[model samples]
Target: MRTLQVELGERSYPIYIGAGILDSIGELCAKHGISKKSPHLIVTDDKVGPHYLDSVVSRLKSEGYHVLTHVVPSGESSKSLDVYEQVMTTAIQAKLDRSSAVFALGGGVVGDLAGFVAATYMRGITFVQIPTTILAHDSSVGGKVAVNHPLAKNMIGAFHQPVMVLYDVDTLKSLPAREVSSGLAEMVKHGLILDKDFAYWCCENGHKLLALDAETLIHGLERGCAIKADVVSKDEREGGLRAILNLGHTIGHAIEAVGGYGRFLHGEAIAIGMAGSAMLAERLGRDESLYGETIRMLKAVNLPVQLPQDVSIDQIMDAMQHDKKFTEGQMVFIVPEAIGSVSIVKDVPVEAVRSVVEQLKGEG
Candidate 1:
């Protein structure tokens, strides 16, 4: 196993990444000081539970921790106020307290919802992440946690850090091809923002990833986590530089919400969003090959590079305005300057935004 640390002083924690790492989760958490005396809750979804829950529960129980689990239906809808409340009620009924720790044992949805539960439960309890998908490689590392709202994605959430993240690449083998492709979008985003070489690497190797090449995935995930961890360490609250992490998320979230959460997977939406962001930047007079390269690469993986033919511009515009990235009433967009390089843009021209979204819609 390889271990990397997110340096946040008092909130500092280590992330373990490797094949078959799930087997050592109990020993790992105990080493990190998660008390065995407190009740432990494993929050998972219906999809991930069958493959992972038993192994996790058995490990924790063997370590002398009283473990309980709350399984939510597997989908983005589970990250709602109603579900959050239901999980909260479960915690209360289980008699869990501040000392209790939450184990988010699935993908991004599970991590976001369960982390939020731990953050608000008795004013903050400990939580650990056992991410089961490639997408969670990004969401699992950053302390950003939240449930979605009708108006916007991840609107109701918090900056709750996990005590540790245990990523087992083996779980990915069981993921469907669609889920696998969806997850690669975030890794692509990570490369686009942090390293030019990494971005190109993802473009070259993404197809291999969908075929489940274990070595490529392990390498891709480690690099993705390192980039995210470095950024989160510097700006834990997204005060500045960390905004780069939202490279394609601003527009992506809008697309996801407008299409209805279940319509497009998070990464699918991101694939299109990143393509649009590149085109928007190009239209704004920032000439970069990233525009064409992003489009070409995303297409190679069968990821969408444009809005659906049926989506209306008005629907997307309405959703974008309500996006969390907006500041004081102005939109802040991340635009690519070159491969692996981006800058957050403000005062984006209305005409340029409309033109790009309209053009992308026409492409579909």
Candidate 2:
């Protein structure tokens, strides 16, 4: 197994990446000081349960671990206070203790919600992430976990790192085409903001990566995680350098919130958001050629480069106002100066944002 570690001092954790590593969950947990005797909770979603949850449970059980399962409805809606409380109640009812560890055995939603539970239960408990989708390659690693409030996505979250992240590439075999495309968007984002080489590699090999070809998927997953790990290592709480990771996320989150999360997969919204931000960058005269390149790369991967036809400018503005990146009621946007380059724009004028949205809407 290829392993990467998140160096967060006391909260440090390891991310294990390889094909068929789900079978090694028991040993992984054990290595991290988790035991069979300790109460273990497996949190998954309806969609993931039938596919992999049972196998995960059996793996841990074979190691003589006592395991319980809690499956939530799958989708962005699950990231709500109601489901968070439900999982917490289940953990409490099961008598999960400080020694206990929670196993998140699904995609981004499962990882985020379960990790949030682990962070809050009994003050804090250990959690392991078993990501089942490509999009999770980013979400599972960073310590950011939380549910969406009614007003905003990820408004209530904590910086609770996991004890271990077992990224079994095998699990992604069942991912829908949309999910694969969604994940590629993030990998694309990594290249845009940090590594130009990786970005070019993605443009060349996106199809192979999406096909779930074993070697290509593993390479992309490892490379993406490596970039994310480097960024998080320097700024765990997103106080500074880490904000670069939000290359498309600032406007992306607003789009998601306005469109009601499920309308566009996180990556789809990012695809459009990145395009819009690139346009904004062009208008601001940061680098016209890079903006054109951004559009080309996004379209190359089948990601939407235009805003949705149904979305209104007012809805987009309302969502941006509620974005977590807003400071002192000002919206901050990360725009690309060039491929493998980005700049943060704070207090972006409402008129500038409106003009871009109008132009995008008109084009669509």
Candidate 3:
């Protein structure tokens, strides 16, 4: 197994990445200080329940852990306040305490919801991440966990890092094409904002990664996590250096909120959001050539580089206005200065954003 540590002092944890890592999860948990006798909750979704959850539960049971499983309805709906409340109630009824830990065993949605529970349960408890999707590779890290408010995406959340992240790349083989495509959006963003060479590498090797080649998938995931670990380590609360992590999120989150949470997967919306941000970058005098290059690479991965047909400019603009990146009513966008570089620009004119929205909509 390839082990990468997210060194956050007392909050520190190691992310184990490799094929078949899930098979050894019981031992992995024990090694990480999770006890067999501890009351544990494995939070997953319906979609992932049959495929991987049972195996995980079996392993934990064999290790003598008292494990209870809670499978939420699959998709963005699981991140609603109602579900969050229900899960918390379940944890409470199950007698979880400060020592009891939550095991988020699905993708981003499960991780966010369960992690939030771990953050608040009995004034905070331990949480382990057993991410089954590529997207979770990003969400499972950095400790930014949350559920969506009725009005916004990830509008309510907390910075609760996991005790450990067990990324079993083998679980990804059965992932649907759309899910894989969605996950790649964040991978693309990682390359764009932190490492240009990594960005280029993704463009070149994306196909192999998608095909589930072990080496490429592990390497790409490691590189992406390394970038995230470094960023979060520096700015745990997203105060300063962490803003770069928002490379495509301002526009992406806006698209997601306006389009409705389930309309597009987080990564799918982010793919389009990156397109919009790249276009805005050109208009804001970042780099004209990068605008085309960014779009081309996204398209190569079968990611949507354009807005949806039903979406309107006004809705997108409204969502962008409400974006968390906005400061004092001014919009802040992350635009590319070059292939491997990004800068946060508060100077992007609203009119520029409007134009990109219109243009992208036309493409759809």
Q: Per-prediction TM-score, please?
A: 0.95, 0.95, 0.95
How well is each residue in 1-364 modelled by candidate 2, as lDDT tens digits? 8988777778777889999998888887778889667788999999999999889989889888999999999988899999999999999899998899998988899999999999999988988899999889999877999998876678898988888899999999999988899998998898899888888888888778878888888888888988898889889988888888988776787788777677889999999888888888887878768767887888767788778678888888877776655565456788788888887778777677778887777752
Clashing pairs in 1: none
lDDT of each: 0.86, 0.86, 0.85
Q: What does candidate 3's lDDT look like per residue over 1-364, in tens digits?
A: 8999997888888999999989898888888888656688989999999899889989888888898888899988899999999999889889887678899988999999999999988878899998888888889889998998877678788889888999999999889998998898888889999898899898998788778799999998988888889888888888877888887777788788876776888888888888888888787777779878998778767798887688877887888777655555457778888887888787676766778888888741
Q: Where does model 3 exceed 4 Å of error? A: 324-330
For residues 223-272, what per-residue lDDT tens digits would candidate 1 score against the true structure?
99998989988888888999898877777887887887778998998888
- Candidate 1 minimal-lDDT segment of 10 residues: 322-331
Relative to the true structure, candidate 3 has a C-alpha RMSD (angstroms) of 1.8
RMSD of each: 1.9, 1.8, 1.8
lDDT of 3: 0.85
Q: Which stretches of candidate 2 lie over 4 Å from their true place?
A: 324-330
